[model samples]
Target: PARFEEGDTLVSWLAEIVGFSPSDTRLAREVPFMQDTSTGRPAGKIDLVVARVADTGLQWYGLEIQAVYFSGRGMQSEYEALQNDVDPYPPFPGAVRRPDWRSSSAKRLMPQLQIKVPTLRRWGSKLAVAVDGPFFESMGGPSSNPSRDLNDGDIIWMVPVLLPKERGGFLLSRGHWEVLTLEESSRKLLAAETVSRNAFEQTLLEKLKPLVRPTE
Candidate 1:
């Protein structure tokens, strides 16, 4: 599936976990947030905006998805490069650089936890982040290294888990939403480590082997 489709799947799963009916949930992708004055282009775009009907009325949340894969180099190195690429300005004058959306690390997940979450809250919306298992594990188990003070009602972490299936295969399912305390997040950050691509793929396959059935 394409990246957007994977992200949508995660968001839909999150909506159900949050107790919103299908009819009550609305997801908008690549929603524009800011416009650049100089280039007349959008300065910022959000991956997904989730709107749901609540008893009080309509509520909205921002969902950011990150699929941290192991490149040949390193995940952290790739992240840093992406961060540098998305920078709107250049380090030196006459650098002749344009903002490249493809290179941005989706605003870097950790930084978003600190900066974007507060901004979203001030706008009357909450922030939720969805990450694949590899990415979740890489970040120290989803609760690691939180820079901001978090509350149960504040930011949420949506992670996928492998569940045993009745049919003898495993199903990748969404786990319970985790609202990280500062302490939990801190510990995770300390434990975070980068894994190689081959190792990551091997581990993933091993975890899913029980779910893969032989061809008839």
Candidate 2:
């Protein structure tokens, strides 16, 4: 439905949402997510890079936004597949997956930055992903099922509705529901549009600030 640039926009917005400055951070722009030469797997890219500096230490952040639809397929699983550069054999396997942008980029950047800094490691890296989708039903809801176990990291499977107060505030989630009625979810999205946009911008600034280099 969209392109990679949309993912970049979302990452930029997310950094701003968490109180990062645009000027202070380093934006890698469109760093390529390279595929495995041998396996021909789908490698996802990192849309944004954030460098955070404190008196005690410095932190590098990687951000990615998943706007595509992966309802039946699990978000984490997709993440993992990209990180590993290996597609699932059966296809649509539900699991948590990480992105390979950090690992591959770090390896490539190490030699370049090592001459100046002399120290670089791939671990302890922080990654954040903003998923764009409707909510999924969790535990303790009306007609809830025991099999539907969703964690915080998991995305909501249902769409949101921003309806008038008379109608209802929002249609949160509907798990395993065959049909989706957008009327309610549309209203919810309308109400949340401003807040979502603002949050995204804030997150972008927050994550981008650290990557910005000092002026000469």
Candidate 3:
């Protein structure tokens, strides 16, 4: 539904980021959640943290805003092409481009969850993820399940409504959302059918054939 240079606009505006009342809410970014066991260096950081005071004590929620990354040639050529063209409108793409959903979800976000969620889960704090509608939908149907109750969920899925602007960007607005258990979200994000052993062996053999020289 939208693209952003960064998630700062949404994160800066109180209404856009947090669902709860803004009173006493504080924000932190790139928070370290885990440390390397061998090196003792910070291994992972939560992209954002929203903290507030509760009657019992300080309450904080983790937020991760995943921006879609594109897989294709660099945009330098497009910029170069636009420089000389007399036409008022921009030219079509020089190469095909598509969002790298798999890398974004499985490789990038999933690891953060795996390392951090165990701690947050223990503390009973919630992790909220902000992503566009289509991006989430591309996860192959994991996010389609009905949202669980807020308190019952370990993750809060926030999908913002982004309206087209006249110039080129988008206007962030209210959006659809739901809640789900970590187990459900994890399964959905990494959803893939298991292959049979024979099938795997065939694929492996096919891959090995090119690298191995023919036996004469």
Highest-scoring model, lDDT: 3
Model 3 lDDT per residue over 1-216, tens place: 134324544454433334545566678878987789999998878887888776878777888888777899887998899998897577888899988888888777777677667688899787888788777887653354566467767887776667878987667765666777777777767866689999999998888746577889
User: Which pairs clash inside model 3?
Assistant: none
- The prediction achieving the highest TM-score against the true structure is 3
Query: What TM-score does structure 1 among the candidates reach?
Result: 0.55
Please provide, for model 1 over 60-154, each residue's C-alpha lDDT reduced to its tens digit, 9 standing for 90 to 100.
Answer: 77777765532243335444555677565433432233432222233344544565666676786666776656555654554443433334545
User: Residues 118-156, candidate 2, lDDT per residue (tens digit)?
Assistant: 121234443443332232221112223322232221112
Off by over 4 Å in 2: 1-9, 17-19, 30-44, 52-58, 70-122, 135-216
Q: What lDDT score is found at residue 199 in candidate 1? A: 100
After superposition, candidate 3 runs with Cα above 4 Å error: 1-19, 36-41, 78-90, 141-145, 165-169, 201-216
The per-model lDDT (C-alpha) reads: 0.60, 0.39, 0.73
Clashes of 3: 0
Q: How close is candidate 3 to the true structure, as a TM-score?
A: 0.76
Can you give the TM-score per candidate against the true fold?
0.55, 0.29, 0.76
